[model samples]
Target: MQRFTVTLVWVCFTLATFPAQAEELALTSTRTLAASCAACHGPNGNSLGSTPTLAALNQQYFIQRMQGFKDGSVSSTVMHHHAKGLTTEEVTAMAAYFAQQPRQTPQPLPHQSFLGAQ
Candidate 1:
């Protein structure tokens, strides 16, 4: 009986020291939510077009824009529909996630001299 009690305590202690598996579920959820933005915003929010990039955007700005979209205070062509379904927690998570990504600055177009230029 003494040996069994010690073994049970050891097992419980080992399990408690290890990280919980629930972390993976949280990562999966964040990934799933971010994927929804890839179509227009580019993968991981590094947009390669006219759309504003979400990567490295200020957290407060991101939240404000998202909340605006959700509340219909921000005018957008499509974001309103997308933002409508997100919970506040999800928005914060997404903002933090995207803010960690590296932002890509768009390059300026090359200057072309007119045919009449000297």
Candidate 2:
């Protein structure tokens, strides 16, 4: 009887921690996926040029645009390919991550030339 009670307590404790573990794993995966966007979107979704900024965007809007891109309803030079590769859950997670970031103007890169002059 005592062994049974102890086992039950252990099982309950393990189950209680499972959700937290899962949540952490999901966040990590989302962050890893989002890191790829930095190539053009800039760090934390702040665009360095004409590309649209992703930080602080409305979550639903982000999701909708991504879905559109995935479905080929939204036109893009490259986004359709990228969007089509992501799972819906990944898109939702990335949207949430970007929405929570604070937007910042990106600084020009060192040695950047302007107006055809250095």
The top-ranked prediction according to lDDT is 2
Model 2 Cα lDDT, one tens digit per residue, 69-117: 9998999998998999999989999999999989997877788457765
Best by TM-score: 2
lDDT of 1 by residue, 1-118 (tens): 9999999999998787655556667777887888789789987797878998888899999999999999989999988988898899999988888888887664565788798957
Residue 95 of model 2 has an lDDT of 94
TM-score of candidate 2 to 2 decimals: 0.80
Task: Report the number of backbone clashes for model 2.
Answer: 0
Candidate 2, RMSD to the unseen true structure: 5.1
Stretches of candidate 2 exceeding 4 Å from the true structure: 1-9, 107-118
* Whole-model Cα lDDT of every candidate shown, in order: 0.86, 0.92
